[model samples]
Target: MTPEPQAASTRADPAILSIADAIAHPVKAANFPQTILRFRNDRHAATIGLDALDDKRWCHHFGRFNPMPGNLPQPLALAYHGHQFRNYNPQIGDGRGFLFAQFRDDKGRLLDLGTKGSGQTPFSRDGDGRLTLKGAVREILATEMLETLGVHTSKTFSVIETGESLWRGDEPSPTRSAVLVRLSHSHIRFGTFQRIAFEDDAAKMHRVVRYALETLYDQQNGENDAAALLNLAVERMADLAASYMVAGFVHGVLNTDNMNITGESFDYGPWRFAPTWDPGFTAAYFDHGGLYAFARQPEAIHWNLGQLAVALRLISDAPPLIAALERFGPLYQQALVRRFCWRLGVVPQGMETDRALVGAAEALMMQGGLGIDAFFFAWMGDATPECPADQQGTEGEALWSAFGAVKAGYAPARVRTHAYWQGDAPQSMLIGEVEDIWAAIAERDDWGPLSAKVDAVRTMGEALRG
Candidate 1:
């Protein structure tokens, strides 16, 4: 039986007060004229105290589309420009989506309520501003999996299937349409700064930097200068990149526009989790050059950070900015070591020990061609680190010894009690599994498989957190 909805405990917050000047351009949502509620993420809604809303009330605010009290008066299609495939595109913006609202989470941190496929704005360059139902489903899975793995990512707030059909080149034509809302820490992208830099608007750039520092970073030490902000951003982005690497996630497109200033991963398009430890794995088919491959993700993010530094030059000199950019490498390396240790279910030792452990673990994965998720899940707590029969040779023994040395530092009683540790197979979200889940939905509209997958992923999350 479905559980009863809880009572509302929170209201909206006026967090994005700079929408009129620093960040966004006011716009109206497209008139899809039909609202069919399909999915609502009550778990995420409760983070901002909106989970108690009835279906009709939820649809009115997020679907039938009236702005909530203390939210933006109307949706604001944010302005920005980005480099697509390394080519600068000045005409890029929130073409189909808008910043619908802003609020504070339970932690009192500012959050954004953004949309995808809500409709067109001045940025919509002659295309139908709608999203296919399949797209919405894909995003939901992506965010859920990422969150489970402890990646800072956006939450899919609501998905309302608009009573319309969309024809697209990728999927089956005349596909069902839907509108999605995502809750994120911030919607201000690196591209937002790039746009002002491109226009040579120094005064506006300074204002944006100050606004971002105050609102997003919560830095009120009179250090809201461009150089200080860039320093903070570099550290955050490095940690974000390391999270992706350890999660075996390839974010397909790491474009400037897709990268938000808060370093949280959003806009899940063509994302994939590696089936095995293969650096060459590419998530997007069009990435024939392997620019954003599983291994090259750190490089892609570093390049994007360089572009951000270029934009910051509008407000600050080059020396401090360059110094800030120089910190990404060490920050990413340290973050990787820490994150890898956590995944191994061990308390991290010092940097040198952790780095050595990460290197040895990667070597083992590559040499044995082990499935990424399977290997991690199997060796989680070192309670019984067994080598596969096929991998019981000299090399495998050496790998096992190294792993054992690393695992000796942690106690296993915490995670051993979890039922997931007894499973024959680890919960994984490889391409085949995702496709199978989608096939179930597309063929018969059976949500059982998707629901089960979510539950399994959540179980894995609980085990890891313990």
Candidate 2:
């Protein structure tokens, strides 16, 4: 389980999964990232795409490839296992999935180019290998939207419709099947460790963890003992949860296996943007108890991190890992406040003001039953805010009140109509257009326009400080 560089028989490295041999098969690298369409309504998790549980992947050059290319990910793919739901499902590993290969994009970012709706493997359990079209469609929309929102997400590389009918609840029965391609840093999961550890491969487990840290985390020299590696892993997950909170993003299904040790948002199952300000909002339909609720996500993430610590503890002592775990709450708080402060056009110095402003924003959003996205959208244009400013406070109330009054005084009625939510106050005309532009950004991945908007938003925010 050691992460020795290019070990004779270690787990799969992203480089091993590279797309060097995949330029010839039935492949399409789209201008925009895509969704798998066929697995949309599988009810397993958010960002559900077509499950490649059964189809065999081939080289990009193959005319009618059945399994995998000789150089493709075969042996390294054997390193994964996970617990699905709350049950200890040690039988999970790429059941409906497999990495086609990993590659460096034109800009030098590493990406895993793989297929969903590909056929079954040893971990197939009992399900079919095919994925439905609607699953593909939903995933396409989810990926595009999330990335546009500036999220660290798995980008959809392409989508392939096999022109075959499959059945599912989210759409008409006898629907078509498809394969989805995703470009990500890594597909390795937390369960990848748990599964091997549970199997009594302490050496293999240690090997894999060491490999992951070197490959993904720092790619630096020297080895990370189990203790150092575990601390690194905890800090990453903590930072990730912190970032997710700031982005108003919620990962609906956060099983131990779903959490990626690489610090990227791994699985998109049952995921959703906060619809309203309710932290209790769950992205998955099956999460009736809100186990993976938007409000609960950070906590859920910490819980998953705890599980990771235990698994890592099998090789080392728990003291350092426990200390790393203790930092999550404060780390989360700082990240949350820092991010919220930036969004509000304020610095982090205003504690009471920042707290009140965020509290007020959430409270007003609750009263309006506005989704997080909706509230932020409305806040961009709100002139006569239903959200009140505390007359007595120096920072919180004054900042909001002053900004609201100045904004309403400057915006045009037509712009207000276009940008403001119903019954909300007018916002600064300069930024009103910004919201409209970001909507376009969120809906489309054609970076031609996205590039301009990204620059424009940052410029506007910077101008506010000056």
Candidate 3:
């Protein structure tokens, strides 16, 4: 039975109190004519005790940009510098988005409600500060899919379509605009530290590191200082990189600013999931060099970690920071095997055996051009003793033989109950399918397909989580 939704409450917490002034600058939201509430994430809202907000009140706070009671009085456009495609960009910051407010979830963890396409700020260069409806829809799909696949990611808390048409170079001209609110662990990024380091501000860097340790890494003993923080960041980031690889996801732009300090995946732009197991699949079209390709994600994140280590030099010695950075490779490799084994519905024998299993699985995927999601979905929980008659060829023999060696002793019955596994294909969000889903919304204002897709994806998530 569905539970009754709770009423909206703006209870305050000691979240983001210290860094508000030091890290972010005040800004205003862009006023639009209409505030059509399109989506609200009730599950995530329940976690933060915000599921009780009625449509009008929800629109007032999210759509109209009126401050939530007991939250931040004014929106804050965070300050930071980032490397865009490996080139340092000193001027970039939160151009279209801002840190709207901070609160605590029921689990006692701090979370940030940040806005995308709220309004123009000092960071807004020559371009207008707006987000297209299509972009919002895509982010919704991306977050939902990643979450279902067991990746730590930000939730798309709310999406309100602002009644305005805007022009863009990528999509059709005069695209509909909307404002999205993302609920994340923290909006502080690697670039936030980079900005302070670039200024050569040791004291400010120390303060930022301390604040981060207190807010995000509360598990720490609060004694080790900057080096401790770097170690924690590296460990979390290694887990994050492994999650992406196992989920077959490609984050198109791995900029320093996009890499969250809490190691959660957010700010999805031009992201993609591989249809087949191709190591060279690139998500963003502008990525001509394939620097952030599917196979190179671990490398990309390791590079970003090095940049974080360099930034930590503002407050700590070089040797300890380097030592922390060196842990990424081993941590990532271990996490990759664990995550892969989980997806394959098997228990890992050990590092050596797990490594061999992973290598064999990848070989099968590449050799047969197997659909990444389909392969997992089909063999989920465990493979049957007999191979399918259609797959009795040499390729099938090699694939099943490699797979049989790592099959779990016991399979969970819950995974086998899912109807998705009964089909020949799995739920996928390839680019062509995403475009088709958007077409229905744009042409006829039909939301049936999109709604159904969300339901299917959520069901998949439930199966995976089980």
Better of 1 and 2 by lDDT: 1
Q: What is the lDDT of residue 351 in candidate 2?
A: 51
RMSD to the native, candidate 1?
A: 2.9
How do the predictions measure up, each by TM-score?
Answer: 0.95, 0.68, 0.95
**lDDT (CA) for every model shown?**
0.85, 0.54, 0.85
Once fitted onto the true fold, the runs of candidate 3 whose alpha carbons sit more than 4 angstroms away are 1-10, 219-223, 385-391, 394-396, 408-415
Q: Order the candidate numbers by lDDT, best to worst.
A: 1, 3, 2
True lDDT of residue 124, candidate 1: 88
Question: Where is model 1 more than 4 Å wrong at Cα?
Answer: 1-9, 221-224, 394-398, 409-414
Q: Candidate 2 lDDT, tens digit per residue, 287-378?
A: 78888777788888888777777777778777877887888887667666656654443435545555555666665556534445544544
- Which has the higher TM-score value, candidate number 1 or candidate number 2? 1
Worst 10 residues of 1 by lDDT: 1-10
Which residue pairs come into collision in candidate 3? 6-52, 7-52, 8-52
Residue 406 in model 2: lDDT:
37
Worst 10 residues of 2 by lDDT: 38-47
Clash count of each predicted structure: 0, 59, 3
